[model samples]
Target: MMLAFILLPLGRMFGQQSPAMLATVAAMPDVQGAITLSLEVAMASAVIAAVFGTPLAYLLARSQFRGRALIEAIVDLPLAVPHTVAGIALLFVFGRNGPIGKIAGQLGISFWGTALGILVGMLFVSIPYMVNSAREGFASVDLRLEKAARTLGASPAQVFWQISLPLALRGILSGVVLTYARAIAEFGAVIVLAYYPETAPVKIYELFLSGGLQQSSAAAVLLLSVTLTTFIFFRYLAYGRAARKGRNQ
Candidate 1:
């Protein structure tokens, strides 16, 4: 039943779109631009998630504070929030007139229809994936190994860098892949927050609305293929010999 359910749709989508149509959509300037922008912004968002989320994940995994559960819930809040509502919430907080936006405006940083806005929208929804993945990764590392290192006169920082980090790297890499994929697939929040600079998902949506299913299918197929390829490739890297590469590095 599961194979039938999944494979049917997959086969249908692949068989439906003509190569000529896919080529046409691929050649469209807007299509190219949207794909480029989505990849670029998604990469940037992954970097941001890594830098900002790593510490939070480490803290959550290692510490046991009174409000630890609450913090975890907060980190996962965006997953519960409707994405469009998430966009609206972001607008309220990051719009030109909003408090943070106003302060940023004074400092020459604007989140209005810019890459920064798109990034914020993606980050809001996708960060939990990275944080949770990384936390689990960190948690899976043996504490005894850390303690043993400590007894050997290694400081906490050294233990974390040399021991905990290396062992948990696969999990962290998984989080990064998921984070990038989530950011790329993002649409609802991005539509409201960064409509001007349309990502591939947004472009496909606009095409669907303005043109129709036939018109949208080509671009849709391209995006689906790209995302699926990336997912498959990253998963391969995360789970197999690629996992070893991260540790070696």
Candidate 2:
């Protein structure tokens, strides 16, 4: 009920938007670009996070090495850090004067004011979702299965690919979904690092500053509609997949 109170008013407000304003928002060319940029960065970030986070998650799940706790803490550090602080930290390391930026510059891969910058920021904040989910998934799988595969002449890589990966895929998919949501919703870090590309959130902020709540609200509603639709669709897809697997078994 309390949640309804908070959300109902906003829902009503969007529901009450004048058709002309809705049309204006829908017709804007940059709206398409903003959507494209948001999807592109979010998808890229999710892919990168899955690739890098999977290895770390696997280690965290399987290893008993010293400093494993420390590594886990470092992996989750972004959750504790403010987005602005994370942005600045990223900038310090990837900015023109920074070491990585110099290497990037040589390859003509600019970060500032580019899609790559948005991707980096998105990955920074969303990776924990992928890592944590994948780690838990890996942990849930019985080690005996992996050991049995190994005893059957499967190499380490083969054991992981055939046994661990398939069993852990559900959790990995969930992580990708969560990371995509997080990346799409990112505002502060992306604005600091790559504002010119104008993701949906940044565009909403810019509209609010330049126009007012009405214009900004229109964009906000659009973003909300798209995000909510995607979220619901994926949730249903995940549920359906689970149900199908259960029936097959």
Candidate 3:
């Protein structure tokens, strides 16, 4: 049932497109541009998520505070929100007359209808993956190791850098991979927020609308291929690192 439900549709989609058709679509400048944009923005979103989410993940994993549960709920809220609704919600903050948007305007930065908007959309929906994964990673680290480091007179910063970060790296990397995948696959929020600068998903949607399934299928296949390839490669690297670390220990 699972195979029929999951693989059948994907298999049909792939089977519909010949290598030549896929090649033709891949060669199209617009297709290439959209895929490139998606990869770039998704990578940026994943990095931003890592930098910003790591502290929060660590805090959530290690701390018990008055509003910690509330914070966790809020962090996970985006996953529950529909992407289109999330986009609409973002527009309130990132729109031209919106608070952040107005302030950003003064700084000559705009989110609406731009790559920044796409990044925002991607980050909004995908950051939970980073935060949650990293939190788990942090939580999985044996506290005794950190305590041992502390006993050895390691500063808090040094303990975190030398002890916690490396142990949590696998989870962080997994989060990054998931975040990138989710960001690249984002369509609803991105289309709502930055339709002009179409990412691969948005471009495929456009092609579907204007040119129908036949025209769009090739591009879809190309995107699926790229996404799957990158996902597999990164997952391999993450797991391979974990294996090496295990052996070293």
Candidate 4:
């Protein structure tokens, strides 16, 4: 069933594209620009997620407080929301007349029809993968190790930086990979928010709309190749680290 639904279509998509067609599509300035933008923005989104979401993930893993469940639910809400709906919801806060947008406009920053808008859209949908994966990572760390470090006069910051963070690195790295993949693949929200500085997904969509299947298929395959290569490389790194850590232990 999985092969039929997933692998079959993917195989067919790749099979339909010749190397010459792929090279031609890859050579296009617009395709190159769109793919580059997608990679850059997605990477930025992943970094931002790690910076902000890590602490929140740790908090969720280590502490219990009022509304903690609610917080977790809220963090995971994006996964449940439709991307188009998420875009519309974001526009309320980031649109030109919206509060943040209005304030940002005064500072000469605009979200509408810009890379910032695309970043915001990608971040909105992809952050859950980061937070959830990181939370699980943090949760997996043994509490006893942190307690032992504390008993030995380690500061909370020291314990976190030396113990907790290291132990949770795999999960955090996995979250980052997932977040990047999700961000790069975002279409509806990115398209709604910023269409000019086209990301690969948006560009492929445009190709499909304007030039039909043959044109779009080549670009789609190119994106698939890039995404798959990156995903595999990161996953290998993560797995290699885990294997080394296990051997050391």
lDDT of 1 at 170: 82
Off-target runs (Cα >4 Å) in candidate 4 are none
Cα lDDT of model 2 by residue, 52-77, tens digit: 88888989999999999999999899
Candidate 1 per-residue lDDT over residues 1-249, each given as its tens digit: 999998898778779988888888899999989888888889889889988998899999999999999999999999999999999999999999999999999999999898899999998999999999999999999899999999999999999899988888788888988999999999989999889788899999999999888768788888888888887888887788645675787
lDDT of 4 by residue, 1-249 (tens): 976998998999999988888888899999999999999999999999999999999999999999999999999999999999999888999999889999999999999999999999999999999999999999999999999999999999999999999999999999999999999999989888888799999999999999889889999999999989998888877768777987999
> Which of the two, 1 or 2, has more lDDT?
1
Greater lDDT among 2 and 4 belongs to 4
Clashing pairs in 3: none
- Order candidates by lDDT, high to low: 4, 3, 1, 2
Give the candidate order by descending TM-score. Answer: 4, 3, 1, 2
- What residue pairs are clashing in model 4? none
Whichever of 2 and 3 has more lDDT, that candidate is 3
Model 2 stretches astray by more than 4 angstroms: 1-6
Assess every candidate by TM-score.
0.94, 0.93, 0.97, 0.97
Q: What value does the lDDT take at residue 159 in candidate 4?
A: 99
Per-residue accuracy of model 3 over 179-214 as CA lDDT, tens digit each: 999999999899888897889989998899998887
lDDT of 1: 0.90
Separate clash counts for every candidate: 0, 0, 0, 0
